[model samples]
Target: MTWVGPSACTLPTVEQPLRVAEFDALFAGAVQGVAPPGPRN
Candidate 1:
């Protein structure tokens, strides 16, 4: 499924819900005390 060059390539949608447990563990382990990126003004 290559989006080859020529006309501007349309990127496919990645419509998967990420697994929360994996991200939760990673966030707790490596990202504690770090504020997430602030909302856009």
Candidate 2:
């Protein structure tokens, strides 16, 4: 599973859909100004 070189590594097609889902979750969280619970200004 290692590309291990000076070239690009390609992810499997099966994993492409999952990438979209991951991006969607991130986008939704950002739109809501979601942040890790911590000290704030």
Candidate 3:
């Protein structure tokens, strides 16, 4: 994946897929809903 800015991610490229899978599992188990962003105050 292409990272855009200067803040470098510590995760190595080889392990990125594992990290993505971990996030997918977490979201599948924990996320309850999806909503659009509300209007700015």
Pick the TM-score winner.
Answer: 3
Q: Put down candidate 2 lDDT per residue, 5-34, tens digits, no spaces.
A: 323436576775576677778878778665
Top candidate, metric lDDT: 3
lDDT, each prediction = 0.49, 0.62, 0.73
With a 3 Å backbone cut-off (N, CA, C), the pairs that clash in candidate 1 are none
Which lDDT value does model 3 have at 21?
83
Cα lDDT tens digits for candidate 1, 1-41: 33234344343434222333455667788874856798899
Task: Count residue pairs with overlapping backbones in model 3.
Answer: 0
Q: Give the alpha carbon lDDT tens digit for every residue of 1-41 in model 3.
A: 53333245568778776877887889899999999999999
- Clashes (candidate 2): 0
Which regions of candidate 2 are displaced past 4 Å? 1-9, 32-41
- TM-score per candidate, chains pooled: 0.34, 0.46, 0.59
Ranking by lDDT: 3, 2, 1
Model 3 / residue 25 / CA error / Å: 0.4
